[model samples]
Target chain A: MRFFINRDRFVHDVQNVTKAVSSRTTIPILTGIKIVADHSGITLTGSDSDISIETFIPKEEEGSEIVRIEEKGSIVLQARFFAEIVKKLPGQDIEIIVQDQFATTIRSGSSVFNLNGLDPEEYPRLPQVKEDLLFRLPQDMLKNLIRQTVFAVSTQETRPVLTGVNLETEEDELNCTATDSHRLAMRKATIERNNESLSFNNVVIPGKSLNELSKILDDSSERVDIVVTENQVLFKMKNILFFSRLLEGKYPVTKGMIPTQSKTAFKLKAKPFLHTLERALLLSREGKNNVINLKTLEGGQIEITSISPEVGKVTEHIDSIDFEGEDMRISFNGKNVIDALKVVDSEEIHITFTGAMSPFVIRPTDHDHYLHLFSPVRTY
Target chain B: MRFFINRDRFVHDVQNVTKAVSSRTTIPILTGIKIVADHSGITLTGSDSDISIETFIPKEEEGSEIVRIEEKGSIVLQARFFAEIVKKLPGQDIEIIVQDQFATTIRSGSSVFNLNGLDPEEYPRLPQVKEDLLFRLPQDMLKNLIRQTVFAVSTQETRPVLTGVNLETEEDELNCTATDSHRLAMRKATIERNNESLSFNNVVIPGKSLNELSKILDDSSERVDIVVTENQVLFKMKNILFFSRLLEGKYPVTKGMIPTQSKTAFKLKAKPFLHTLERALLLSREGKNNVINLKTLEGGQIEITSISPEVGKVTEHIDSIDFEGEDMRISFNGKNVIDALKVVDSEEIHITFTGAMSPFVIRPTDHDHYLHLFSPVRTY
Candidate 1:
């Protein structure tokens, strides 16, 4: 590729595509980033089999020249070292020239780097997805959904499907659920799309890819176009294309894991509840599984206690601002409560318990768009 | 101990001492912080065998009462958890009451924590150092000297003494030197001491402990008292006492390793040279030793080159702003140069090379107080 491009713009685009650059050299070509310059623009692609990210820098942006391409060609350079060099190069404009032999020269300011470039033909092409089954959603909403549920996805690769977040659509409502068999987090939001009454029952996108894409998405208000095929999913936004390979197997039906009814429910301030749970977590560290007991007393108060035979017991009484139903006691992993409390933006949160052995649900006092369910530990 | 102390003051003191607290709980009691309350004030001490830090919270400060002691006693509480709890606790003043049954009640704001406390008698006693061999130095100057040389110390504990920085004093000059055998860094400053000319030969203080102490010493302008005993070194400042156990054995005579004469010398802008070295390091990663080659061209320019058989070669040229002695070329560990340059505050640095195989010295153009030496690696 022979092009003169704005260093900052090129650097920004390179960083976005680098999110999918493979660190493992198992597939040597995948460790390099493919760069192509044509009449349209300069395109950069990075992929690691599981996910691929491509960013395009147009010849001109906002009436300003961003890139001037002299020759149409392609070359692949080592992703990590190239990115580091480009970032540290002291210049405002960078000139990249590729010779017939695939030798690349990057000159900026007073520094010029001659790097060995690989034949881009050796690099694997990104899978193309049909636009027929496309949908649109606000980048911020999608990012929020990913943040709220992705943490609950199983990190272990033993069950590959569990490591992906399940995304299902019924009519206009999109439900995102992630569970590790222990705790489940689900977020539901409505999106405006051209497709009518569409449903994706068991579509599972790898949680790791979604997390990486979240960081790449800069403008939250911009609507991103998502196209889904049988095995590949593509997110296109503002000259950047993110493609992720979907999990093959069907995702487990986590809907059955969440309770539809509750036996006892109480409203507690999110910040205070989080602080009290943190204190209990200190004591819980001495226990086998960092378990803390939550007891709702006769009055509007919750007593969080953790005990260890050798490290004594700690009890923290937090007054409940609001309460309903019957008083009850339950024990759970203190870390679970801490995780659930972090995403809760509401001043007060309502926690409901179905029974001693059943999963409990925590939701914001005013909204139903997000819900967190925790499987209570059976403490003997 | 029964006392109501200013929470902020107490927490600050506790945090300083807790820096020396051992993370490994092999000796369970060692992980706990010892607190002793007297009629004068409360003293908190944390130790990890090799290093101990003691911080004293006086009963009064700036004509204001900081601690109101109700009784005199002592107890040991878990350092890590206690520091976290105290930092997070919501209160201006914390009430500490030690019961006859060895139960400690720490009340702050609306929260009350009843912790199981151990007898302080079980805690290790602080090492007593005679004040006769005391010296005084500006805290900031001492910290700067430590920072300049500590990073060059050997990290591997194979020869335990090499992990400590050697401090020697002659006349009014206090010299500190550290080396990993491959490279050495030395810093010297003039200081006032009670002894006319005392030499602390082979006195090695652990690099890890000095690093931690450097972070704790925030007020560099304050005077620091240095007390040396047979096996311990104490740095006493206002309300804080940092004690480090000296590493046994003779430190290698690094003075002999430094070349007294040089065959070639050059003056270069420190920042630009650092940037050039970083660029050369990128290509060096492909080699077995990650070595970069430096060559002095016919013109007033230096060429830095690195080549990998499989991954291409990189050549970067930096114009020499100034040159002296003879035209020469040398190669060394790029990482060592980068590390040494990070501590150099001067704009211009003078590099003196004895020969291709011998160690080279880098120092500020006009300063004699600081010097950094790096051993060159054979590129062939």
Candidate 2:
């Protein structure tokens, strides 16, 4: 089995697949990347059990030859070293020859590297998901939804399902939610789909896998086809395919956690509120729960204060152009407020509170597409 | 105490001094930066026992007022948090007011921060080194001398003094050497000194401190004054005073490790050889010593090879344009060779070897300012 491929094209595809390469050598063969060459093109696959990434370099691109398959075959080589060698190769084009004995030789300008290759048959095959349940969405919208909610996901392994973002689809609307109990973030968007009223409630995809996928799909205007199955999900774009195994278990009903009514709400500029929260966090670090008290004073003003027995106290007053409600005082983790404020892009934000102890909701003053909620701490 | 200072100028000085701030809280006060405001200006100091950096912000610079001191006093605040706040402050000028109780109020554009401050008298004072034993050198040359040899210093604390670079001055020549037993790097430069035939030998400065000093002295053309004492060394540049404690005990004699005679010598381009060593290092990761073999063939060519039982083998030939002496072979740590090559700025390099088992020398083809010696590993 042998193949001669253009170095630049091969390197590009190798990098894409290398993102999913297993750093842990638990499964010896998984640490290597599988390379298969045939009449059509060369495919590189890297997997770490939870996520698998495959990139294909065609025989020709835009009427230019990219590869020449002398003999159709497949082999697995160490991903780490192979990628490094390909990137550092000194030539514009590279020649790869795989002998019948499974010895792979890679040669470029003035440099040649021979790597011991393993039988590709030893590598696990990628699970095939039927495209019947596929839905297409703009990559930009999907990336935004992931970034907005993924950071709120529980990173701990105690409740494994909480470590994944829950995606629910109803008719033409897509809802994504992530929560770690202390704080929760959700984003909603519209996508074109033929399956009317289809609901994928509690379909949890690991937050880490989503982040990696987002980094690989940097181009915004491109459309990505997502295929969902009972146990695995696939995202297809250009010549790359990304597959991630779905977390097994039911996601908690977060709908009940978000308050349906508010006793008080105030509209404040997002930047000013974020800066106030940051200042409070600085002072809160010396306190027990990193807690800061927020008081809605008369005449559209909010006072943020924190006090440490040994470090003294700090007080900051931020004025709100519009405020209406009974004056209220509440204490909450300053970091939670800062995190929630970061996801709100609007200049003005409306924050609603249902008593001091209940979870409060914060959203853009004019947009219903994103919502952030934080549970206030009892400072008594 | 009260003072109004230019925010940008204050932030710059804080950043420079914060480099010496201790991350560990073993001595709580060491994590705090001491700020003293006088009628002249404000001085900020940060120290972590091993090194101390002090930066002074003058009341005026180039006929423009940078600081307006209302009252003279001093206080120590947490270095990490203070620096962060100063950087994020919203105004061009910051107003600082200190109360009799030591509660400091820092105000900027619509934002006020009150931090608990400590009495500056508790902070350790800088060591006094007599200015008589001082010499001047170009900052760029000093930085160059440090970078060329500091990497070879022994990191292990087994021999405490070996962890520092030894600087010796004789007549107008300044010589520096560092070694980790297996390899050695030495650099020498001509400088003007007060004493015509001064011999300042065995002056060991900590490797870690030199690294920080190198980063702070970014200007190559500026002149820096060096003051040496029995226990401390000071580098004065402009308004900054950098102090480092000297390493106790005698440094090892590295002169015998460098061989003056050689049986084989050859000249090669620095870039090509460096790239070849990098490729060999990539293949050597599977071996215990990360060893790469180099053999001088009959023709003016050198063969580089690395083999691993499980990772196969790689062999490449590098043609030498100029060569002389007996044909020989040697093996050394690929990492050491790559590091040595990085410091060399010349296009052509000269390598001399006494024997396969003896230490070899590498230097620029036309310069005598720097020399790198590496001991060959027994490949057989």
lDDT of 2 by residue, A1-380 (tens): 77788887888888888889877859999889999998999999999989999988999999999998988999999998889989988788888888877899988877888888988999999998888767778988888888899989998999999999999887788899999989999999887775664557778999989999988877477889888888999999999999999999999998888898888888899998888777767667866578989898778888888876665566778887667667898888888778878877789998999998788989998989999999899987
Residue pairs with backbone overlap in model 2: none
Q: Give all TM-scores, in the order shown.
A: 0.96, 0.96
RMSD of each: 2.1, 1.9
lDDT score of residue B22 within candidate 1: 77
Q: TM-score (0 to 1) for chain A, all models? A: 0.96, 0.95
- Going through the candidates in order, their DockQ values are 0.51, 0.58
Specify the poorest-scoring 10-residue window by lDDT in model 1 chain A. A307-316
Q: What 10-residue stretch in candidate 2 chain A is worst by lDDT?
A: A193-202
Task: Write the residue-wise lDDT of candidate 1 on A1-380 in tens digits.
Answer: 68999999888888888889878758989989999999989999999989999898989988999999998999999898889889888789999999977899998876778888899999998897778767788898888888889988998989999999998888888899998887888899887777774557688999999999899876468898888778888998988899999998989877777788888888888998888788778778767587989898778788888876655566778888668788788889888879878888789998998887888999998989889888888888
What TM-score does each model's chain B reach against the true chain B?
0.96, 0.98
Which clashing pairs does model 1 show?
Answer: B140-B220
Q: Which number leads on TM-score?
A: 2
